[model samples]
Target: MNTPPNPAAGAASRIPEVATDASLVVPVIEEQAVVRREVVETGRVRLTKTVEEHPETLNFTLLHDEVQVERVPVNQFVADGATLPGVRYEGDTMIIPVVREVVVKRMLVVEELHITKHEVPTQESHQVVLRQEMVQVTREPLAPPTPGPPPAS
Candidate 1:
């Protein structure tokens, strides 16, 4: 028995003839598929910040001042109608009068406290889609033409 010709195999030769008769006999066979892209929640990416307080030790120095007083007695003869000097400097110390002959010297003592700030850096990783493309596949079979009465010769 002989088999019928395959349309797909002979389609190349018949393409011109098919084109000529396409307006009358063949319904314009066209297959159209919608192309669309959707963002799907395949999974999830989450960034969480956890705040935890911990005790930290800081070491450094700060300075402030305090004053001290010392007393010394000067037993010497006073001249007729003479007064002690109002202010005098000995090295870095300043001597000032409290009253007639009683004078005091000023000096400084320092106390300390420490304050410091620090910056700590950390690293972490998370999932991301840097670049993305989508593809859709569909299969549609051609419908056979409906039988109609022969055209006028």
Candidate 2:
């Protein structure tokens, strides 16, 4: 059988239809946290050295050789072809007698000062700690929205 063409039916089809269910179902929108970590410069560390001088006294023993003079009066006559006092060994020291026709002045000498330098090695250690911020995500279900009145018929 042939059905009548209805203009209202065409218009109704163009419009969307609504569901008759009493309870409406909808998707709930949610947001979550994303955690990310990165390395960054928080601060800086520097090492500096300073020098200061102060008066200090040091005592040390120093060994050195020096000349010593001793005079003795001997009224002995010297003849020709006779050996005079010369350099001779006396234990760990050498003794030399300088004979002259006239008396002469003599002096005594001694050791003075000695200086030396020394270098020493040392070790140093330093430690540093770094920190950063991170993001964490958590999710939970929520209650649905309240239903509204049905669409106009």
Candidate 3:
């Protein structure tokens, strides 16, 4: 006996859906709340310290000597190619730690000099000064406001 093949099974299947306007469709958006933080910068004064910790972490105190100039010329920025405004004992210290993989050079100063940086939130108020000037004009001073009601009667 011969068997007959099913015609519906041989055809490809399609998914079912409803027709809607493409222009009217809009993607949903999520609104989120975010908080911000306040960051403050401060100053400090310190000297170099080399820390060597085995099997843990090591630190290298990178430092430079303090040199003072007798006379400062106009606009030092133009004179020095480097942007260093000046040497000040104020600001954050840059501590670089030494690791096994990193190659570094260590130098020992002949004298351990004091290093200073402005403390964090350093004397910024000092930068501003309010000076009040009073001018005394000799003009009879308005006769004391016309003697003010007959000297309290």
lDDT of 1 by residue, 53-127 (tens): 444444444444444444444344345456533455555455553333323332211211122223344444444
Write the residue-wise lDDT of candidate 2 on 1-153 in tens digits: 899889899999986676786555568999988776666445444444444444444444444445444544444434545666556665545554545553333222122112222334444444434344444444444446468895454
Cα displacement (Å) at residue 74, model 3: 87
- Considering summed lDDT, which 10 consecutive residues are worst modelled in model 1? 106-115
Model 2: per-residue Cα lDDT at residue 66: 50
Compared with the true structure, model 3 gives a TM-score of 0.12
Ranking by TM-score: 1, 2, 3
TM-score against truth, every candidate? 0.29, 0.25, 0.12
RMSD of 1: 19.5
Ranking by lDDT: 2, 1, 3
Candidate whose TM-score is highest: 1
Could you give me the TM-score of model 2 versus the true structure?
0.25
Q: Record all residue pairs in model 1 with backbone atoms less than 3 Å apart, i.e. clashing.
A: none
Per-residue C-alpha lDDT of model 3 across residues 26-110, encoded as one tens digit per residue: 5899998877665533433344444443343334444445433233223211222333233334244332222121123322222
Higher-lDDT candidate of 1 and 3: 1
Identify the leading candidate in terms of lDDT: 2
